[model samples]
Target: MELRQLQYFVKVAKKQHMTQAAEELRVAQSAVSRQIRHLEEELGVRLFVQKGRNLQLTPAGSLFLSRAEHILTDLERAVGEVREFLDPEAGEIRVGFPHSVSVSILPAFISCFKKEHPNVKFRLKQGTYTSLIRDVTEGEIDLAIISPCPETHELVKGEVMLTEELLAVLPPNHALAGCKSIRLEQLKEEPFVMFGEQYSLRPIVMNACLKAGFVPKIEFEGDETDTIRGLVAAGMGVSLLPELALRYSTHIEPCVVKVDPKVTRTVGIIRRRDEKLPPVTELFGRFLMEFQPSADPGRPMDRLDGA
Candidate 1:
């Protein structure tokens, strides 16, 4: 019901031992237990169920724990925002990047941003683009660098960062190895090794194939681009990967074929549409959209979703 109660609940939920939580909070065990009991009675739902000396959350308790953590996190963020509003240059911004973006232009972007905002520390979180969007929308991250905008809710899209193509990475000895360009139709029959359904790339790859008139026969799936490329080189199956996905490899010798000018990816910034822009977040978003010297800008993407 209160901030202090939520803090105690979080500490106890983490330790699953009231005595330990009280020790960590530097309070009497009875005081911690009393507050927890008061919270449970007020909500008319138990937050944790005890089993002898050990502790664990019931199904209801588990769900409540997640909500409690979020409530506490939101409060902390609200306080931090107020404090930062008073002293703009002194707070940390938690930024999340797609796994793909971290390898590409992010290094330069981070270096450049740090030079300008040395007092501002960045806490980096990495995940796929879909997850990044969800985190940013939920106030988990101040800004997210992700692939092209889709029909997402409560997100503000910034300038396009870079346009990229979906390249087919084929093994050196594959039949299409020497080909400079391969159409989506040509790859319709090839076995594909792709990221799982959770990745944004999977939807794009599947849509491309469905447009080409065949369903992709996904033979293997992985979360990492390098792993997928390695699978390709080992003669497992070919993969559709973006430029950012290919940044960390030297071992796999795969021929990357541009899926033509029709199929490309665009990177952009995503922030919560509901939230007022803090100066740091707004500045970082623009800094992210700036062109990098080595960015291999791809062809125009006006017709990317066309069949």
Candidate 2:
């Protein structure tokens, strides 16, 4: 089928109305209808059926839509790669990151990279740890900045940048809040606020508590680090968060104490091992490997300070 036919088919599938699809594509309604009919004929399957005023895809149609969309995305990326090769400084990079680093680490790297390559554009996606890794493996994102970076994955490769400490965060009025360092077992009786199961940090916190000899009693679960911190500050419960996540906490400051055992997570960049990155993505990946934050938040004396 022609490229235009695929384009028209996708547009029609999305709009589900021949007239609206035509309007968006800036083409005659008859032209859109003709193309859809031709596409269906060529594929030897009925793609759409009328549901009152709107059209809906049949099972075959739904399957074809997914493949068609993938083809279109691949074509777009292929074209972008050609243009990027010609002018590496003026291309787009799609990067994924987890919520734990959204406030500090991701911004720091992006700001530093942009200072030298101001014209390079970035599309950043913040997701759960599992989703970020899956996105990289599936080619949804060119790179991902992940914590507790995996050592062995069949589909992706990781480059560990640095290991950062995970500290105990408590409500300011808690008795242990004033201590420099406390054993994990010391807070065993305290109710815990934790990240959801999807986050990589949750298991780390769970395992640390398990190692400390008790299963934590989770009182509240949050998806965002800020939300968990807020819950802790509001006296909801105590939590364990990465040092980077607490670096810029401004509102309702939670007391950040060092865990005596000193739990840490490795921060790293991950990309698909099989795919060759575009010029701009390659450059950014190289920069990340060489870049270091001005101060290591994981240091023992680094207190949680609001920005």
Report lDDT per candidate: 0.76, 0.89
Candidate 1 lDDT tens digits, 24-128: 999999999999989989989887888888577778778888898888877787788787788767677778887677765677677767777888778899988
lDDT of 2 by residue, 217-296 (tens): 99999989889999999999999998877878476899999998989889999999878899999999988777555475
Which ten residues in a row are the worst by lDDT in model 1? Answer: 298-307
Error of 1 at 177 (Å): 2.3
Leading candidate by TM-score: 2
RMSD to the true structure for each prediction, in A, is 5.7, 4.0
Best by lDDT: 2
User: Clashing pairs in model 1?
Assistant: none
RMSD to the native, candidate 1? 5.7
